[model samples]
Target: MLKVQEIRELIKLVDQSNIEEFVYEHEGSKVEMKKKAGIAVPVAVSPSVQPVVQEVVHMEQKPVQTAALQTETKQEPAAAEAEQIDTSNLHQVVSPMVGTFYQSPSPETDAYVKQGSKVTKDSILCIVEAMKLFNEIEAEVEGEIVEILVKDGQLVEYGQPLFLVKPE
Candidate 1:
């Protein structure tokens, strides 16, 4: 059986990862974890104890509530329209993994790249911190950065576009 602290550590690992589901079994003990809408919930089962289920039922109902609220307020479409950008001709610099996006190396340093900055294929653009490791993201294509898609210190997903660049 896993200790309470171990289980908590596992939960924290799962929550920080890109994994959708994880399962572990040892000597007839089973622990399963699933992530829904970026929320990680763990379920543990053992032969001697009843299965424990923790479900986020409210998260499942949020879409329905949001739809009703959108119709009632009639504001979502306008907000969406205002946030739209033309990306058809831009080259996207995408995050290679799920992590916290940092615009600069540190708090006092300037960002590696900014809008209107010229970059080569090997130019470092930003850093994505995952599991306490800072992975420097590069501009994989030679271009001029047209826009920064995400703000500093934002949580980003794998393959999420980070910048729009006009290829040189």
Candidate 2:
């Protein structure tokens, strides 16, 4: 609910103050901050995605403490990157919204893309049904489908990874 600058300012203020814990909730949005080792860090929660944590480290040499703001996301992208096999530079296509995952255009139709299938930039990988609408999910990169992250009819959350592709 707050702007990035406002959030940054809040983190800075919390870092500088003696307040051990700070919690702010407004209109279903919440922010939690804690004082850790004389530095203030924020722990953010989102209903659809993973938790995002930002760490602020203040140094006395800096007057504005702008340099203290650094994001250390709890859902580490590095760890995800490490999990991918190094043989190919795999790219993950994630669900853009909360929906039911579907492998084919329809039950009788063949799957748009399957494991080991080559896909071009415009290839339709699958469909995601959200609010009774079927949204065609297209491949943004040319690749081979190494893995399918969700099964047909599976409910997927926003940002949930759906496919792993080895780029051609």
Candidate 3:
């Protein structure tokens, strides 16, 4: 069993991590935490899963299985179009948080970045709205936008590949 303060700290860790869910149990007491809009939401304890404190790590990211992401019109994972893009020379910039993806700052504004657009490490490539806060997603690596794997206003999952970039 864990104390309230310990659980709270754990919640903060999970909320800030790339992992989606966490679980901790000792004897009879159990606690679960899942990220929901930069806040840790406690989940009702269930007997099925086993994890002391599940932090959402990027290693566990799986492209959400959805037809919208599997289309042939330039909206699939690099693996789906590997032969066409030559991913060996590209690196992916993924979503750091789960939220609504917005390509442009506003409906009337131009997109922050587009295909063939050059980007620096600090470029604001997109915005992710979570918990009513518009967080700017930046390009951590300099590159040219090779492909956008998602559409505007789509519900993006944590660690979802947002753009495939070819190193400059």
Give RMSD to native, each candidate: 7.1, 12.8, 10.7
Q: Rank the candidates by lDDT, best first.
A: 1, 3, 2
Question: Tens-digit lDDT track for model 3 on 66-122?
Answer: 333665555445556755777787889998887789999999999999888999999
What range of 10 consecutive residues in model 3 has the weakest lDDT sum? 52-61
**CA deviation > 4 Å runs, candidate 2:** 1-88
> Global lDDT for candidate 3?
0.72
> Model 1 misses residue 6 by how many Å?
13
Instruction: State the lDDT of candidate 2 residue by residue for 16-115, as single tens digits.
Output: 5678999877667687877766666665644421222332222232433344243223445555764665635688999987667999988999999888
lDDT, candidate 1, 1-168, per-residue tens: 555534544555676678989897867778787886675565555653222222232233344345558857775654465358677888998999877899999999999988899999999999998766899999989989988878899877779889889998
Better of 1 and 3 by lDDT: 1
Candidate 3, superposed: residue stretches over 4 Å from native: 1-83
Q: Considering TM-score, which of the candidate structures 1 and 2 is the better prediction for this target?
A: 1
lDDT of 1: 0.74
- What overall lDDT goes with each candidate model? 0.74, 0.71, 0.72
Q: Which candidate is the best by lDDT?
A: 1
TM-score of candidate 1 to 2 decimals: 0.60
